[model samples]
Target: MNDQNPPAERRLPPLQLLLVSLQHVLLMYGGAVAVPLIIGQAAGLSREEIALLINADLLVAGIATLVQSLGIGPAGIRMPVMMGASFAAVSSMVVMAGMPGVGLTGIFGATIAAGLFGLLIAPFVCKIVRFFPPLVTGTVITSIGLSLFPVAVNWAGGGSGATQFGALHYLGVATAVLVTILLINQFMRGFWVNVSVLIGMALGYVLAGMLGMVDLSGLAQTPGLQVVTPNHFGAPTFSLAPILSMCLVVVIIFVESAGMFLALGKITGETVDPQRLRRGLLCDAGATFFAGFMNTFTHSSFAQNIGLVQMTGVRSRYVTALAGVILISLSLLPKAAFLVASIPAAVLGGAGIAMFGMVAATGIKILQEADIADRRNQLLVAVSIGLGMVPVIRPEFFAHLPQWMEPITHSGIAVATISAVTLNLLFNVLGGTERSLLTGASH
Candidate 1:
């Protein structure tokens, strides 16, 4: 008889649940709002419109998270998953905006169509699970972590566009936050240890505030209560070209989301079979479709939160469900949203290092169980990791590529996933060695 416990039963107490959920909210809030901020600016929106975009993104993201973490029929993965705006769609949406007569309405129209495309393709996408044994999954997961480190470094340097970016004070603050998290992890126990990242971020925020680095001016301007209305940017007008572009973006999101789901499955000790994988992808598609009506961008699993799950050792899906509630509340209460948004980038950077690093570490741990000593397997790992770094180190490396191919080569995670899956097929499956290796690894 099986003795393992299901994910739903690993619930935390009420207070612990709230705190842990808040930590997740803090970790993901920056990324959740980033898409709308970028797209809003690209579309030449006013300050008020941008704020509306942010609120709408958060509201849809919260709903998506609930669908992802708490199962609704066959739609959700029923695991500790957090859904948010996908960065993969940004480039395409921006391009659509620049096209005459497209703009924000076209973006939303394409988003809706692409989401429906994703929903139709999700079952087929799940079939790719067979290609992702420990070998490919490890490489992809490791690539995800490596790809995110640059973002953390940029944050540690006082964010990308800061006037004083990379200043000594910013680095110092980030280092202090990193050290605080490390110290807490070492000396603390039980709940304290679990909340180390939260405490670290809180301290870093305070330190940055003391240094006059934190900005609170926006909070005063933000309204106390805001409603997220559908089609706030005007009625969506679909075009074939934009819809096709967004469909490509959805394909990339599916690949990245697959890697994240598998990584989370490894972290929580859950078996992500084809059925579970299908449900997760379906939720992503459903939320993205909903996002179009809600004045938001495409939705997918947030990779950083997956790292948080590994770091905190809190595997309860209910925790993430509570986080969904918190996100909904924040979306409705703009003042509180702005308050959390006021946390300095340097503070997030410190906590991010630990959270993102754990994802890479988990991949390494998984790799250790694979049959990597074989020369073919070794080459697969080496080549996959190397090619994956191309987009990360030089994002414009594929700028000259055909527009249709941009979706495949633009993202580090997408590149890594392609490399890993293709190489595994060439060196293992086609070479007739994958079965033995997988069988051995299973032992």
Candidate 2:
């Protein structure tokens, strides 16, 4: 009986597990913090208000990430996945913010409705997993990386088209941080190497502060212990138009999650069976609904963390669960959250370049598993990836397109998903006479 059930992998000592878990938290922190910062700024909130929003986002993200990784009953995928507010919902949110009578309440109402829509569709959406062979998944994952590259570049250059962009201090700080990460990876081994990003960021903050670049003035003004009392904004008010818009956003999220599920499957060497995919999507949808109720925005899997998971090869869902716990704790402590807030964006940019690149590399690995020798399959991958780049490279390319089309065109995920699914159907599902030489070799 003992031999029949071989012992599980030895659990690392508690300290070791905590350190590894911290690495996941560090890798995800910048992106997690950015979502709220961006949304608050765009919404024209005051500094104090923005700080409050940031804390709320972290609180919600932590809870959502935990729910995703730890799972409950049939609701979660129980993977080492982390969830956060999505950039995918940004454009629509900005649009909604401007609409008369819609305002924040409208956004909240729509998010709640959209999240429920996501929950309802989870089962049906999971069935499409079969259509996502490596070829299709590879293209979609690659598109995710391609889409995020501009974000990294913008941060590196002092953020999205800023007037003071390309300042000498920004470049110097970013370069130092990037070099620190590389040197740690090259020389440091084991756990220290795993937390290179975190260490590099700490170093960057000190260096930036010495140069009088880091701002501590905000810290003094920040509240010491501010609890995020729920219903901070009056009770949510619903509207048909806003709800409809949010539903569209939710549809895009499901499509993106489909591609992400396939990508995760390839990375983990685990099958994302219909059941697992269903649970994963439900967790994401349910999390978004939770965010709305908590006076936050939509939530989804943080694509950035997928790279960290692959790089460190720390595949335990427990590690991410621990991270979620830490995040929640931080959210409850305004002073502690402010400490993370002080980290310079340039420092974050350096780590982001490397992490995002790793995501692209994973996509490349998936492509290698694809049968590229098949000319027809080759054509499908090529076209899908190219179309996905349209929105990423020229974000405003579809600005002049119809208003109803805004939801889809503004999203690289939507573009990639549509192209991949359509082309896959054309080349694989239909099984038409137009066969490629490598078709038989694909499996």
Candidate 3:
């Protein structure tokens, strides 16, 4: 258990590594499964189909985590990074799901294209980060969480198409789950506090089962184990708008991941030089590009796992590699996937409220890093968020716009990102400020 000289590079005992890796896995499991669940449900897939999506997502996540934690050629960052699906891509994927003549295949097609786009730009991602400072990233992240609230609300109401939609029992269960999560975070510490969402969902599921709301039929039908294969959904169908939408998402992921990598470097006492940064960003892009053919969404480092590393003082990349192994094993168990699929929509809504709200809260926290007192910065946040809400509130606001513009208009995150970046450039960059506000200074 060496803990010196760039701690992340050290190797630990097999038993110690396994335990530490399990902790990381537990910390991220809830979030890891969330994207597939949301996207599968939004796509109107059957429970079995949704379970398959979960399997594919987990498999790709495990592979991505491995790539991030173990250097392969010049790709991996080789830090204590656990990679998973990105929430930044969710709104766009959901939009694609509902678009006419575009569904899962369209979503995957866009994901593949975005991955390639990310790889092409990985070497220059660090430069792009300046353009998306806290002002812009915060606004976009806040809008992402805000835009997805309707989906959570709908789930709490017993899913959009459920016969018992809006049933009182469903709302009650969701509220109870939300309360449980709040209480756990309030009273718990260490690992317990970290997994509050998972605990809340588990409790909600059990409660739902007692009330005859849980569906276990799928579990009986599901095989005990199943090997995940590439393109489980079908051959992806490419489209211009969806690809552009996902490419924007890749940009957001790269910017956010850059901050995470720096944070990890500080934690592990390793200097993240340009080469290391390039390697890390390349891994992120490569995993995402691989995710498309593997039947999953875009992949990025899990921020929560970084917190785990900080809290536990375990800075070994090998630990995360072990976690990747565990995730890969779990992905092979169809029963587990079916069990997760059996979780009632109401229960998921409860956890979704907590999870998605935290995303918004994270954006607000990031916004504090920006100078919000200045009216221009204030307008930057206000106008960006307001315009971002147009698509969420009125999907038809851009109906008159060219159909080709749907990539930027239909997704609120994309709209907010474009607006924030454009307005920031207009006021901060073009206003003749010598210091360049893109650097987050010289107000």
Candidate 4:
């Protein structure tokens, strides 16, 4: 027999729980609202409609968070997890929203159908966990971090559309924010260290505010204590192409969520057996279902929060459950969500670099156990990383490809995942040493 303590999902004091949960919400808030903002623009929505989309997105995200953290029957995973709108689905949604036959209604229908598809496949995905060895998962995660760098750079440059793109002060603000987080983490202790990101963001917000950068326009329009109604975009109209596109994104979500879940288990000392894994995935699917009706995009687990979990050494699911409550409030009180969004892009960039960089570093740490020196593994890592960069390096490289393949080709994570899985199968599962050599020779 072995002796060890249970995972960190234990209860904390009510006030402490509330504060910690708020930290988690604050960390992911930028990412959670981003999808709706992007899609709203691509959909050519009015300013007011875009604001409503953000509100609905946060509201539904909160409900989904509760379902995942505080399980119900065969649904939630009951883990210390927070769910948010998926970035993976953004390109497809943008394309569909801009297309003539596929507007808001079509997007919803596809999202709903994709959710159902994900729900049915979650069990099968859980059973196939062997395919994702550390190498594959690490590559995908590293790609996630790498792909986000462009976003950070854009933010630091005062966003791509800024008249003064790459302005010196923008970089200065981002650097200052980054420094603040680093200093807090180094000197702070216990809970303070855990909330260094939040503290850094707060400092950055104040700094930017003094520089007259924070925009209150969104907040001025956002109403307080508003109710989000279902099908706010009208009845969802289903179409085959968009539904298929969304299904691709759902598959990507399954893979990324599994990687995140596995990594969190390692961090929190939780053994994510197949049963628990399936339940977690079901929550993802259910959240997607809820997102569709609630005028939002699909939801998935966030890796940055996982990094925060590791950094803070807090594993309590209850913390995240309370976070769900906070998100619900943000949803109901549009002003609250607007307040978070009003944070300057440069400020968010500084914190985002640290959060997303930690995610990539986590992947590197996991790779420490893998025998990467082996030729097969080396090649796997090499080619997988290369494939991942294709989309990030040249997003338009696949533009000439058929529209049907855009969802897969445009996503750096998806490209990496496919490359890793296929390479792993050939090198390990099929015992293709000779084949690898021949392929290497041809190259």
Candidate 5:
């Protein structure tokens, strides 16, 4: 038999592929929704305002995910990747929210301008992929996980600024959700095992509702349907200060996307060439632009979903495209969207702990493939990861730093990426003859 012809046993049925794709959606749903909720609260929006923000975000995220997963002209990655709001822009949005007279319109304008900047620079940034070897990618991805953990912790404690934060019922629900996930993972098999997070979350939702820990007052108040009319916050008013801040956000997003693309490539055994990376970046930036126009935030690849893809071995981009469709449908149906919004924070926190932990695990798997026998490589990973953890462990450690420097110092992923790239260049790229010879020989 010809070498290719004998691979019949390796092919998957269309139905199996569909199921695998659905698994990916379940894994990423909670994470994709969290960003809008967090930002809406920070912006001091009402419950209705928060719901609108979330619905709009989901709609844009779905559209962006589709664009990224399914290639279009010269602007898509054509990978099994899901796109959502980039947390890197969270800090910038917070600052924008406080700008006098800027309001929501200013934020939207800045996001659109920043996205345009990202699109313009995408081709150039894609070329920097070569700088992210496995070691660097691993460190950055790990930092992404570490950075998000605190958000989960805050949610588990009933969300930040909550009057009932750390309430006994909230902790009880969180514990129940965690226990449910562990049980499902322990006993489930095949597809079910891969979707334990979803099952656990569903179970937690039901249990929390039964225990009176879940609230649905807002759901009842929400309208049955709502159309997302663009420019709802009045036409955007672009200003230099917010624009510059958002541009910085776009740069940070590009850096984070590079690391995420590397991680996805390694997990799927796919070659992320410069052209594909460029298209992916373009899609990300384009999505953010679209989001701004639709009254939302910056959009990019969901890093947590990368682990979901690896965990379930579901490499179908179509699945995420389908998820995008589901999200769009939710956005158009206010009642349905409100129902999802009604899921208790503790339930989301429980699911996040599992999913985020998986992200960190993926980074460890990548690190295992690196040539760590050399002490320098080990040191590179060590210093990078340690530096990344600084922000997570002590959120206020960099408070005294200059206001402009806050974005860079506050981001754990950014810090890790800088540390890893700088160290790798210093130790491996520009070392002395003896050090270089040793590195070469080890490789």
Candidate 6:
């Protein structure tokens, strides 16, 4: 038999490529389309306009994704990365969208400015990579998984006030899908095991259709043909306030993205040095810049989709590049876009439990290689993860802080990164003899 186990950069066969790409697109669809939905509704746009915004978002997201997976000089991570609008920038963009003078064009201007700001700081942000020893990285990665668990729970309960939230039927279906995935994983071999998430989702989609839980009403209104055009909302108009606000949001994105890049490095068995991190950040920045021209919001790695890559064990960058192609086609076909969008959140939630839990498990594995035996390191991990959970448990915990400070205080990953790096330096990097006592003395 041939040794088909090539490196992650190698392309898969065409049929397998589509199968795997579909999995990634489905996993990331909700997150990718959400920003335009929020901003469109908040701007008091008509239903048709909102729909256009969504399609335009998909178009830009597809292009951004391609840029990430395929290298462009200094841009792109050249990995299995999916691109989407940054949720971190959502609040700021929404406010900008609704502001009296700063309408959609203003939002675009700020987004473009933020993209430029991101490029300028990419080098500085990537330099922080050295500070993230496995201890810090592990803490942040574990927090990411733990924080995402609530999203799965909310989805399983029918997604943020479904009127049928917490219905037994919803839980039952999600459980069935999850159980199917587990069974396939356990009993199936090789490729079958690898595509278990896709197979499980297919079963869930069919089951939802049989039970009439899948709504197709949205498709009825969708036009047969839709197109994404540049400057659909008019040329961007830049201003200091909105631009600065977005610049701050972009900084937060950088901090969050650093964790993701490091995690991917660990996932793909690639070393994530500063230069590589710089390229990845630049790809995100370039995507955001183009999003402004294309009338969309900021772009970043679709973090949840990283879990899909981890779960499916499919690491081909070409797979994600094809996922981009599928997204572009969907953006041009509103009916098909509606069909893909109809896949219920509950179905995704079921698969998410396994995928996200694996991310936390991976962090634990990384921590195993760290100096867990040292008493100081133990306290560092404990306190850092505890701090990381504060925002997750009580999102309002930082409400008293100034508005500009919202980005830093509200981020659990940022909190963990700060705490871990601080303690590590004190306990290890700045090691004086008394450093042992600053923490606890170890065996």
Best by lDDT: 1
Instruction: Estimate, for each residue in 198-289, the C-alpha lDDT of model 5 and write its tens digit.
Output: 66768878988998866777666678888787987689889998888888888888888888888878776678889889999999899988
lDDT of 4 by residue, 345-389 (tens): 888788778877776787777777777788889888888878888
Counting clashing residue pairs in each candidate, in order, gives 0, 0, 0, 0, 0, 0
Model 5 alpha-carbon miss at residue 154, Å: 3.2
Q: What is the lDDT of residue 413 in candidate 3?
A: 67
Candidate 6 overall lDDT versus native: 0.83
Q: Taking the tens digit of each residue's C-alpha lDDT, what string does model 3 give over 19-81?
A: 678667755776687899899999999877877777887898888888888888879888899
Shift in Å, residue 235, candidate 5: 1.2
TM-scores of the candidates in the order shown: 0.96, 0.91, 0.72, 0.91, 0.88, 0.94
Off by over 4 Å in 6: 1-6, 432-443
Q: What residue pairs clash in candidate 4, if any at all?
A: none
* lDDT tens digits by residue: candidate 2, 1-443: 42232111224457867877776776677777776777677767788777777788889888877887878877877777888887777877887777788777677788888898888888898898888888888888888887777777777776654468878888788888889988998988977776677778788888889987666766776677777866677687788887877778777778888788777767766678889999899998998888787778888887778777666656667778888998898888888877776666777777778777877888888889888898988888788878888988888988888766776898786798799889989877776534544465443
Q: Candidate 1: which stretches are off by over 4 Å? A: 1-4, 433-443
Whole-model lDDT, model 5: 0.78
Candidate 1's TM-score reads 0.96
Over all chains combined, what TM-score does candidate 2 have? 0.91
Candidate 4: worst-modelled 10 consecutive residues by lDDT:
1-10
- The candidate scoring highest on TM-score is 1
Q: Residue-wise lDDT of candidate 1 within 1-443, one digit each (tens)? A: 11256644487778888888989999999999999999999999999999999999999989989989988988999899998999888888888878998999999999999999999999999988888999999999999998889889888999977798999889988999899889988888879877888888888888898999988886777789999989987898999999998999899999999998988999888999999999999999999999998898899999989888999888889999999999999999999999898888888888888889998888888898789898988888888888888988998999999887777787889999998999888887876666667677542
